[model samples]
Target: MSPQWFVVYCKSREESRAQRNLENQGVYSFFPKIHKERILRGKKKVVEEALFPSYLFVNISQKDEKFSAIRSTRGINSFVKFGMSIATIPDQQVKQLEQLCHVNNKLAINSDDAYKNGDKVEILSGPFKGITAIFDIEDGLERSMLLLKILNQDNNISFKNSALKKAES
Candidate 1:
């Protein structure tokens, strides 16, 4: 029987562990990850985050005898299912996801559309409304870190990305 892609739901925050266990069982799996820029302790850092948290793809035949072993694998909750049928993914789609992950991993900390370091920005709404600050780095998907000058000291502050805009030159 030919192998097909199947989805495996993992225990909370245990996708990595599940992938490792599957590999040790000789099962091929794909756990997609994306690179993200974050600020930690006032320092910029790049981190890899699961693109699909708590889930990964495994290539196995439907009638494979390893099904029982896979079900008992550590950190694995179960194979995704719909009613009595197990969930499956198209090979093409998985290939596309792999390509996208490849490109994302190679991307720089900040993309061209993202704010650059030292770029002037204005707080749109918040306790710091209208305050001008220097762009620090992206804190996460929806937040950013900025350098705000307060009382002659530069303070690192985090704000919702929606609360900030490029300051007009």
Candidate 2:
């Protein structure tokens, strides 16, 4: 009857609400969120959004847990299932996700492997604000370079990862 992590499929846009309800019921849950940079109303803004929309992790011991109460909880759809059996997540996976949540929450820029050289990007802040440039990541850290066009000539410039944002197609 040891506690194991399970995936909960929550109602649309109700991941936070569902997590609260589960916690109130004494069920341990993990809801990872990330800061997302988005253009809102023609201005740049950073918003906290769920890392996985409509999904959350719950740690529960099936033998000692109240399945009926959890199933009927408001804002929760049901547990993720495969056929007739509910899926159980490994503890190591949960711990890794927890670590990632902590690390990613502190980062202003996404650490995902989506950036590559020659990719179009825009500077979100600093002297290069509003200027589009080509992405050039070096050493996979904060220090990176950018290629900007000046007078029809490509100019290479160094910039921090936080100062860049992906350009819209």
Candidate 3:
């Protein structure tokens, strides 16, 4: 049978629990991750593994007997939806995720500071174009945020390295 990918509906904020439960059940799944510095109650900074927030992908046969097995698993709320059926994830998205997993090294997530704060760059994707913005680089250089200057406000926009081709000279 061909492999099918589907989005699993996890309990509100209980994605980790669902992932663990699925693994214990011997179900093949994937949860992509990235490193981000977060502030803890200790007022100290530390890197924590967050479950990319609330999403996970599963590979299984829809009409197989095990389909019922998954529906009964703990922490799995339901399959993702559209009308009255499970929402099938697009192949491109799955491919992108596959590429991410195939690579070795830390994945860059947020662009709190992906560029020089005062550096100038053109807007890549948005309503604004031919306009310059301050490229804000983060402490880790994992990502960069483009702070657009509009009127008197700085509109912050972030982009991963692949999303951005390069800052046009």
Candidate 4:
């Protein structure tokens, strides 16, 4: 059988380590990452973060590769599976992800692609953490305006773009 792409679940915050160990064992892996601009101690910094936290892709041929070796690799928790079947990622999807990461791994801080007006967003930090709000507009390069409801009243508030994330639907 030919090699197929499969998802590997790794220890928390150890996707890179898992990838390295897999590569050392001659097992090909892909750990997708994105460059994000973050504000740290009042300074803007660019940091690389795993696109899929705690998860990475591996290429393995069941007919040729030892599954036990992969499972025993450091930093790897297990192969992502459902019941008795191991999940596999379609080759085309993996190719698309590779292309996207290669072409634009750095997230644009001011790009409108990050959010759109009236989109629901969640406060990721600060006093508003755990609160859901409606995205209003980008106040500037680093700040955004959101419609937050408090005491049944919709109030306009501004927060750093890094502090908000699109709320899961």
Pick the lDDT winner.
1
Q: What is the lDDT of residue 23 in candidate 3?
A: 88
Give the clash count for model 4. 0
TM-score, candidate number 2: 0.64
Per-residue lDDT of candidate 2, residues 1-169 (tens digit): 7888899899999988898998899999998888776767754556889989999998888886576688888888999999999999999998998898788777866547457778899899888899999886552345567889989999888888788778998
Q: Rank the candidates by lDDT, best first.
A: 1, 4, 2, 3
- TM-score of candidate 3 relative to the true fold: 0.53
Give one clash count per candidate, in the order shown.
Answer: 0, 0, 8, 0
TM-score of each: 0.66, 0.64, 0.53, 0.64
Candidate 1: TM-score?
A: 0.66
Estimate, for each residue in 1-169, the C-alpha lDDT of model 4 and write its tens digit.
Answer: 8999999899999888888888888889999987777777754566788899999999899776566688889999999999999999999999999988876764443365578889999999999999999999777568999999999999999999899888999
lDDT of 3 by residue, 1-169 (tens): 6568888876667777887888888787776655546646633243545445567788877876767787677877778789998877766888787676545224444445344457666655546555666676542323457777678887777654333433666
lDDT value, residue 103 of candidate 1: 84
- The stretch of ten residues in a row with the least summed lDDT in candidate 4 is 104-113
lDDT at residue 138 of model 3 (Cα atoms): 43
Model 1 clash pairs are none
lDDT of 2 at 39: 63
- Give Cα-based local distance difference scores for all models: 0.90, 0.83, 0.65, 0.87
Error of 2 at 167 (Å): 24
